[model samples]
Target: MDFVDLEPEIPDSIQVSRDIVYKETDQRSLKLDIYKDEFLVEPAPVIIFIHGGSWTTGGKEDYLIYCLAYAQKGYVTASLSYRFSQEAIFPAAVEDIICGIRWIKAHASEYGIDSSKVALVGGSAGGHLAMLAAYTADESYFASGCDENAVSTAVQAIVNIYGPSDLTTDFAVAQGATPKFMGATYDVNPDIYKVASPITYITPDDPPTLTLHGTIDKIVPITQSDFLDKALITNDVIHEYHRLKGWSHTMDASVPVNEYAQKVMTRFFNEWLNGDD
Candidate 1:
């Protein structure tokens, strides 16, 4: 396939809204950006993008290109901000993501969004949070501080890009990033690491998932996705995995890799979120 431009201008057909607060914490306010077609006659499926920064950096703007591109394809798109690991640890980012989903569902009508067809897409640390939020939708542990308790955080689909899945793995344990984010050494609090792992909660009833990982990704290690794929297979979850060759972490930043990912994601989303149940 030909290389795609990473800096395309958003067309006028899509409407953009920036910095809308989704949740409030004593420390700061969490916000998100929404993009959608201005004249949709029916509710469109939603895709919420989370950014990657090893849980301590990046922001909602990190996925601007994806948001705009998907909005042009008729899906309501959003990118959200969450508490970084520097400010809060473990479930804090996951909680913020759940709250963002709830906020999107709560305002679904205004944005012409189909609340039942929501999808979570994230890269690296964001991907980890996306899977955690989607997998634990029925669990109440992470729902404690969320405002819209009645609204479900459940998603119909998920797209994880080079995200770490098993935090208890030896690679994760060896990585200082994991320890910093969890606020404890793996030995000191193995239980918390297990709980924070997305693969820990897989089941047959979980949403359809799509995973993309670079084979040579050293930052998060491709084995993370390998373990996730194995878990999903064991649970009989509907899923697809793309192991890109000769690529490293954040390969999507490369124009060709991003193009390939967009095409795969478009097909995956169409099959899972837009297709008949």
Candidate 2:
């Protein structure tokens, strides 16, 4: 499915820069769309958005509205495109996200973003990348092919919308995308599955995370978020999990459930990214 070229309902104060190339690999170029409200103070907090297509499809174009929504709320938002599993598997997508964060920080001054106050927000496959990227900042396992820099890739907060947290579970095994993305099954490559799971990297030093999951989600079960929540609590990391009752994966804004999720996500970002708690 193609994403509509629909612009978000943004105020005149907001300005958007489209199709900015953030990284160049030997295989492909990674790009991102940046949005910022000029009315906000200089050096605004940044929000990095990762698009979800189960690691094989989707692009930054699909998330322009989401980027603008956060930009309208006084942030410099970037919706990034990464290498898909079809082109490169396992750590390739994660490495691309890391490089995107580095590119954002390296160009922070030019983009009016504060390098220290960045957050990540994603849904589904993108959510998995966001959480893994944020949690594995100190690990070198998935850092391959990423930019070599002293600049930290750790995000201040994360807003995950029904992302898969554990890759070794039955839920992941049931999904064809998982094996394709990992290039092997849990039994065949147990270490790869464990390393890719965000639940393996959680620590107290990790940033506050907010997860919103639909109880009736069919693609990624609610148990995925439950696994992440348990790890966050065990490590004493600040986090919140909101279980959307009688809801499914596709959450259009016209739906009350999505509206509520937007409110919660906004508040969560305000608390952690904007220091408004």
Candidate 3:
């Protein structure tokens, strides 16, 4: 497949990200910004995107270019901002996403989106949340929102773009890799680490999924995705996976090395989001 870079352009459709605070400690405005393709004759399905920064240092801005790109394709795309471990801890970020999903559902008509067909796409730490959002104990949510229905935030499909799937590995820890969201090893803080991992809640009921990782990725390690993929197979979940060669922890998104990953992830989301696969 021939891959091309997305062009830059300011969008014309209405846009907004509602600020919803899931916790008092996570006092910052956890917002979900929506980008529209148009004020259509009929609303379209939504793709809620969560950005990557190892879960500690990402923002909606990192996804602005992406938001515009997806919106141009007729999907009501949203990018969110969640609190990091520095401000809070595990489950808080997950809860933040739950709140954002609810907010989207509540106002779907305003944005011309179908509340029943939302899909999730997250990178890195955000990927962990997307996985948990679909497979976790449906009732494990904080119960801090309008939807008393615990399963309302369930996404139809999930796209984990190089997220750490399994949290029990020791490679990153043994190598003394720079601490990201799960800063220290589980031995250092077992309880918190366990709570942050998505594998703790995986089940056969998880939605269809798409996963991509660099073979040379060392930051979170491709083994995490391997373990998750194995579990998905054991449980019989529908999924797709892609591994890019010669690609390391991505440094320049504009470089030729990461071009393949970019193309694959977009296609995965397109097929899942558009229901063409």
Candidate 4:
């Protein structure tokens, strides 16, 4: 059997996916795959995991394992895809994500997902968007031709896995990353790069965040998490930072999170999402 041909025939207790409650572009309607233990009973908190590939190279299906992992832990997990850089830039991907959240809120009762207790989890580029969805409370960021209030774009907790928080760095290493996805900075697109960086929007009202990073990450530096950690701390926002010593950017894959890291992450979500889990 080929991996691509393999369909996860999840049990009836779990729901696989459903329709587009809302959309960004008519041609590019967003989708959501719901995995829940039940649909008729108590509503559960939903975890939306956005995958990372430098904002230009990945899709929702790439995160199937992550979606299942969280669903098994008793949450309605939806892995989502957004418009990539080449197709559309900054706010398009973010708008699609906001639409997905609004869909959950609009169909909250039917899907058995709590609209209030949502968490956005992402790695790298996805992490950047997750943080934006959590903190950018502005109403004008997205196109309002459709239902204006549909996208809440707010999250209760944040998990940034090696996400880049800074776009302007004196260090020659990370300065090039923003250009690859954002085009030329010195060109007429300065505002584009500004919004892509999450560090620009940190505020006191932002939700609590948990960041995991590695010391040797070549793609995104450890200092990226450090800056976010310091800002969150300075602003009195609740945050927890974990540094995977001797690990690289893909530490979650290359290095063991160890017993301690797992305990901390699990506990953070458990306590934050579940009142007493």
Q: Taking the candidates one at a time, how many backbone clashes does each contain? A: 0, 0, 1, 0
Each prediction's whole-model lDDT (CA): 0.90, 0.85, 0.68, 0.71
Residues 54-108, candidate 2, lDDT per residue (tens digit)? Answer: 9999989777777777787788999999988889888899989998898898889
Candidate 1 yields a Cα-based lDDT of 0.90
Q: Which ten residues in a row have the lowest lDDT in candidate 4?
A: 1-10
Q: Kindly list the per-residue Cα lDDT of model 1 for residues 15-66, writing each as its tens digit.
A: 9898999899976999999998787678999999999899999988888899
Better of 1 and 2 by TM-score: 1
Model 1 TM-score, 2 decimals: 0.96
Q: Give Cα distance to truth, residue 169, candidate 4, Å.
A: 2.0
Clashing pairs in 4: none
- Give me the displacement of residue 249 in model 4, in angstroms: 2.0
Error of 1 at 58 (Å): 0.2
Judge candidate 4 against the unseen true structure and give its global Cα lDDT, from 0 to 1. Answer: 0.71
TM-score of 4: 0.85
Q: Which portions of model 4 show Cα errors greater than 4 Å?
A: 1-13, 18-27, 144-151, 170-177, 186-188, 258-262, 275-277
Better of 2 and 3 by lDDT: 2
Query: Tens digit of lDDT per residue, candidate 3, span 96-118?
Result: 77777777777788778888788
- Candidate 1 pairs with clashing backbones: none
List the candidates' TM-scores in order: 0.96, 0.93, 0.83, 0.85
Candidate 4, residues 75-145, lDDT tens digits: the string is 87887777776776556777777766766777777778888888888888888878876777545655534
